[model samples]
Target chain A: MTTLTENPNVAATADTHHGPAKGLKRWLYTTNHKDIGSLYLWFAFIMFLIGGAMAMVIRAELFQPGLQIVDPHFFNQMTTVHGLIMVFGAVMPAFTGLANWMIPMMIGAPDMALPRMNNFSFWILPFAFLILIMTLFMEGGGPAFGWTFYAPLSTTYSSDTTALFVFSVHIMGISSIMGAINVIVTIWNMRAPGMTWMKMPLFVWTWFITAFLLIAVMPVLAGAVTMVLTDKFFGTSFFDAAGGGDPVMFQHIFWFFGHPEVYIMILPAFGVISAIVPTFARKPLFGYASMVYATASIALLSFVVWAHHMFTTGMPLFGELFFMYCTMLISVPTGVKVFNWVATLWRGSISFEVPMLFALAFIVLFTIGGFSGLMLAITPVDFQYHDTYFVVAHFHYVLVTGAVFSIIAAAYYWLPKWTGVMYDVTLAKAHFWCSLISVNLLFFPMHFVGLAGMPRRIPDYSLQFADFNQWISIGGFAFGLSQLIFLALLIKACRKQGKPVDAKVWDGAEGLEWEVASPAPYHTFSTPPKIK
Target chain B: MTRANLVLLRKLVLVVFGMFLFGFALVPLYDTFCEITGINGRIIVKAEDSDADKVVSDRRVKIQFLVKTDAKNEFDFKSNQKFIEVKIGELSEVSFEVKNKTSSLQLAQAVPSVSPGTASLYLNKTECFCFSQQILQANETVVYPMRFFIDEDLPEDISLLTLSYTLYQAQSVQASYSKSELDKGAS
Candidate 1:
């Protein structure tokens, strides 16, 4: 293994001192991708639980729909923080963590191209969330304006903590922008010698497009928050109608960043599903090139179809029609990707490994989410569904069962390689089954209540919605508690208490990542592997 | 980082900055878009020809006037008429009565929004109180007049349009009053 004479630089960097540094110092001062990746994963896990707890509080208060536990303002704060923490703290960071760990390994690169910036990006997140979380304890309390934070609600009528909310968002934007730049540069500069653009894995391709979308929109979010800051503290009338600025303008700016931000969360899930379906089915991904095109088309269409979110905000008939048509057009590319996933699974010797189970659920459940989204895209119909619980159900199906299930699948898929041990198969399958059943029970009924005219972001509801709300809250609590099983399983695997795994952890897994030793020698591809 | 990496980072940084500016740019961009399409019912009233000869149609539109005062503003304001029937392209005048209920002299500005948003483009104001800030003495009451007409091209389907004006306390005037009060206290 010591081929120092062959490649002296590789030998020097891959010397015996290659494992992680001592304890806290390793995570603090290290620029290694794997260590940083682990840090990101653990951090995201904690945020996920915290965000989940907020959701529980919301569910508890809405359990009987009479505000039994908390006040309306606190409930509003819970809802707002719950969404913020999940989107920025849990989901996006989790994807970035996956990217950090897997991108270098899959591409046959030694490390991310900009390692120091990677460290900077990861570290900024905790502090941003700290400031955001601290706001709940402040005098006026955290942002009560929904995560959308429309004008007046977030500005003149908001509490004192709105400024802190704005700044926390700014730092988060900086961290995301830096993270995206590092990804784009690494992929652009660090692929193995034989790996052409076409030869790259689906995960890498999806992330490449996702990174570009992040760079394009995160700054717009920064700008939107900045205006919110000015309007609240400084003397800017950006969203105040009396000062000749329109409140609807804030919606335009927000959803412009916002709509793409939704895709940014899910595109990587597509990548994860694309990888898993082929592995479990023991076939190459069908229409891989077309899948790539579909992902790109979705990202492109995301930019123009933003106003579909603003259909009820008084758009002209032509404007509404244009956005309606554009929004519906997205279903085409999205449909192509779904078709390709099913095609890859068609008649193949598919195994229901934990990862495969989650992937299959993703295909079916995510398509349900997509169909709801298409219904929401119809301009007139959306007028009824705009702020309803139906909209809430649609996104949660996509985000919770869709994006989050992919993260879990990726975790199970890669856990063996990361830990050098096989997880308990029975426990992993049970966890998947619990999550699958409980997540549907939680979000599926939201569509029915939403159609029956239950509005979102409120502490109490009419007694008519009582029965369904009780079931949804029960499902929510079960889903929340079930995740602890995942936590225990992950902790057990990390302690190396399970049976040892081999270099190629799965029988059908294909990628440079599987070619390395289990527990993945702290520094892999010291000499870049030749493709073909 | 290598020089090439540094250059690429710089270029990407510029793109981020450009998008940040683009976010702010969307303000004016939205305004122009709305103005052109009358999407949000924000109408820019340019002085239109008020000549009686300009009447091209005898279609009558029911124009409803609505007035609201901000919660923070101490003013009594109401439209003289709840609704009026006016022929398209024929000039009409409507007045709103405003009285300063506060002890101090105050200034107010009215912001107007037209509903059935498509009708905003057809509702022309030859002269309107919303064009300038109105200053009133303590306990002063005045009838403010707005002269306007509906264009003959007003959407055929829209027979009724609601014109609403919300009066807000002018910030500049409030700031000046506060400063003067502080100065008097010091003296």
Candidate 2:
């Protein structure tokens, strides 16, 4: 039973009591994974607030319909920036942040294999967001195309500021790719001696796959946006038909990157759920091997299903059918993951801690989101659903309730470990219940309205859709405000004046993370633990 | 460095370079796909009934009607003039001039529906295209730009096709105004 300590050269001589780096130098030149991880988390939180405010503006406009608060154009800008910020700035970074904080501790690693690059990865984000928000003040205003930035709309008719949007996205993609590379390398190289591939935590495995997906597709996004920039400013007609470019082709290229991007948002959430469920249930994870395979299957399926988003854009029938089948197949693996979580909870001593509560909610609500996704995968069904409030409902269910919820769950589950202080159970559970109910109220009716043919991205809608839109707005505002409770809880927890936690925070916890003391130090695993 | 460490470094360089190559080749590969999917617009030659009946002179007279929109609501609507056929390899700017054909002053956006319902006409302003929706006085003629040239890739079988605009009048605040609403417009 050899451990990192067995290698005295690596362990006894290694700095065990390494505190976080000091001053501006600590932030700029430090390679500490936890510091970099915190940087990512704080940056993501700020972007979430900014992006959330944009959503409030969007909801305010849609509250009563008829283009009440903002012009359809500015409303569009809100929609575009809101989407870009949330997907890249909020969800992706949150997951990356979690990966940074947890992976080394979970897998018994000393540190991320490349830590300087990790710092570079995080700092790039604020600048990217700043450039993007600045575009709102530009000559024609920021990008008004939906986050998808579908062609002709993005290319031919776009604003002068779209060039700025393109450049900012390029930098964001670079950051994501670098961050992902660091994850993949650390996972591959730094695992403790006895921590075999199967022994790795689900969080690490899912991120390992997610990182690969990010690397493969984010570059494609950068390339797609680059073409748009050239098309707009350089007189190239990559999307201009007069110059022999087809606009539909731009869609093909963009979605090739985009569909995988969707999976990138959710896969790590799957990993987080997998980790949280077993720990709370006081049982071993059901079908652990299957969970791994299912994650891999989802990532593979992601690439082929990009065309599902473009079905109504008039793709060839064969392409449509191929993408449809590929997309539906994903539901099988996703369903397996869900079943495993529920099955783990079955016949076990399960108590609803804040983390467990959010986890359980994720299982139910994400499945609901998954079912809608299955419905959207059917080409004929999607033809009816595309660009409608239904698509909006489907994603918000998965994202706000699905990915964002998992992040909250993971936060609560690990907060004790990260801060050595237990959160207020009453307040944390209150946040969970309010979020779950309000989120459903917000997004569930969108399915009905979307099915009834309410198009999305329109500042105003026809009278028939008015009632549901109003209800959705109320739910949205409530959900947005409820997040403030989470912010307050986090602040209170970080102050370290709450319930004291033992080394293993959860009764059924496994993995190197719980093996370490709560409130993980600046440098953990200076000597990696033996897994076996 | 240890042998294992050296192997790891080599693998890292290869993987990184491989990824770089994949990214560098992406645009060209996408361009190839685009070229394959792109439909070379047809050259449509249709004589008026006079040419069709052989009643017109052999000396060919080419008449081009420029299609243009008023630059108001220009981007609000998606337009396609791609199906409109012109002579192959012809060096003429086929313009669709959209006159505020309405009697009352109207701010109208014109889209040159070309490029197979996928291409939008990008309008650059002579000055600043400051207002997306132009303010046209009654009986004012502000020509919108939907200028494009017939590509050299036109096929021989196709002939004359028409580029027509069925312009819809936008709802203007002058005709129907509100303070809260007017303040929110994207100028």
Candidate 3:
């Protein structure tokens, strides 16, 4: 086994012996991390567009409250498929793509510890999604049961395509498990000699914790879908009340997987913001050790707080109290993270670059989502908010503004390094402003309508909710269109049509990644770089 | 993978497998939790009237009876009375009438649940029709009796309690029973 040493001038002996293979085989057979990262990213973008179109169908239907576009059953399919696609296909794969591209570069590693397995992990995702999307063209229509796919709704009362949903989810779980395993092995075995745990970049640290979480919870999800499959086909009574099983038990198990899944989506975003906030502020990160500890605490607390999602399922009083308190405890570490970001920008030479603007918006907007989450964590109040549009508003805020925005920020921050050309600043800023205004228009009114008793997963609403629904639909359209601007900007940059960038694109950026040339060579750190 | 790295990866794989089993283990774990807290309203049936010699209380508690049958079950089932007032610690008898409307022999089992779930521990059954499966020939009708009592230690605030029983086809139960019987014959 070769060990990395702290030598700053090791680039002379670095391996750049071979160039990439040409055409389709390059993507299909390559073990290069950057190439694999691009493949994962482009795939996630396509899934995002498809999922967004489903959301468009939903919004168009809800524009007038009486099923203006699609029928009610089809409407249910839209909501269900939209949720499954965005969470699994879009957001998760995008993060994994970013990890693939960035972790090795940031930690000064030659490549992922298990490169062949990384190739296998990326290839399985498309097949998984194919089975999932194909369910829509089947006889009885795709899974109309909400994304949660609760028992009975997904089993006895479901369409024939329910079996496909279960299998698709199983394959997705396999892909995620393999991806997470590769990340854990890469970060664990491949860091440079001087890159001790504390000295590692925050992005690497966050992915380290997130990978552990994925390994722990993805199997529980596998167990859950397995039970659903058995109950539907094998006549098992795992969720059948008449057969001595309880429906509420299914909720407990799913949420045990689900709450941690929420963290898996967001924790990496925290790492992204940590890197961006410090760079734009022209200062070192505030309370670095505290941020790492806070992240670990949040991941640990996620396990005990799963039942907060099941507060209305008639749990015992003690059980309710325990989950409520545990859920609320998450806010402390989350508060520390928010405070650290704000302090990092306190009294420094702050810049309003595209990435910085997104980071700032993330701090403000994600906190709004967090505050709403705190309200939902109160068990008694959740009874009012459960299955309502307010619940919808809260999650969209965290996911769209919180997770998706950070991803956009990371793209803009690293585009120069990836493509060797600078992206159009004016167009990027326009995209950000349009999204910021329209996403609020899309989701903010949902809280009011939801509080006014507008139930989710329905095609029709009372006339009282008609006006807000119209405005929300309009906002949805604007947000969807705004993404096209981002697409245009990405294409221009990737074509290398803009001016070439220096190795360190941002004046304030610091890391091993900045030490390499712009448009990072296909094989980086053939001999690992030394850190002081 | 190096030997140590291989060992670590194997350990992580084991953890994943262990958690998967833990998911299934949650079923039995949930049952044990409910048994301890009596939060799911599931009742425990005793074979004989061991608490018959206990003193009866003067306090009266309103007991409401509810009965239902599975959607696929071809049986007509109903309670003798909708509601009754019974004194705590006094053994009370209630009967359910059931008729198997199917054309063939069928087995059925009743699963009992109580409302105000905390009261499940206080409501004990000395003998219940739910204790075992009942086999009925075509068009057979029978009155099934359940003997139970609200313990004297019942909380004062709960003046009303609901007892519900749902009947289900006992195919799996019968299958297991026949397997055990076959074992007995062999032994």
Q: For model 1, how does the per-residue alpha-carbon lDDT over B39-72 read when each residue is reduced to its tens digit?
A: 7887764555566456657788899988999889
Give the DockQ (2 decimals) of all models: 0.41, 0.06, 0.47
Candidate 3 docks with a DockQ of 0.47
- At residue A366, candidate 3 shows an lDDT of 95
Q: Give lDDT per model, in order.
A: 0.88, 0.73, 0.87
Query: Each model's TM-score?
Result: 0.95, 0.78, 0.95
Give the candidates in order of DockQ, highest first.
3, 1, 2
Model 1 over residues A1-532: C-alpha lDDT tens digits?
1111111111223555766555466677879888778778888889999999999999999899686899999999999999999999999999999999999999999899899999999999999999999999999999999999999899989998999999899988999899899988888888999989999999999999999999999999999999999878877788887666778899999999999999999999999999999999999999999999999999999999999999988887888999999999999999999999999999988999999999999999999999999999999899999999999999999999899999999999998888778888888988998998899889999999999999999899999999999999999999998899898888778767689888888898899999988877778888899898
DockQ score of the complex predicted as candidate 2: 0.06
Report the lDDT tens digits of candidate 2 across residue range B1-187: 2365346546654665565556547555755453354322211111112112222222222222334333444322223234443333332333233344445666552212323321111111122111233556755554444333333333333234343343434443233222322233332
What level of docking quality does candidate 1 show? acceptable
Clashes of each: 0, 25, 0
Query: Mind giving the per-residue lDDT tens digits that candidate 2 earns over A1-532?
Result: 1111111111122354455444566666767787777778767877898899999998888888586778888999999999999999999999999999899888888788788778888888889999999999888999999898987898778898888899899889889988888887788878899989998889999999998888778877877888888777776756654443457678878888888988999999999999989888999999999999999999998888887887877554666889888888888899899889989999989987888889988888888888898999899878788889898998998998899999999999988887777888878987988888888888999999999999998888889988998898998899899888887787777666598788798888888898876667666787878667
Please give, as one word, the docking class of candidate 2: incorrect
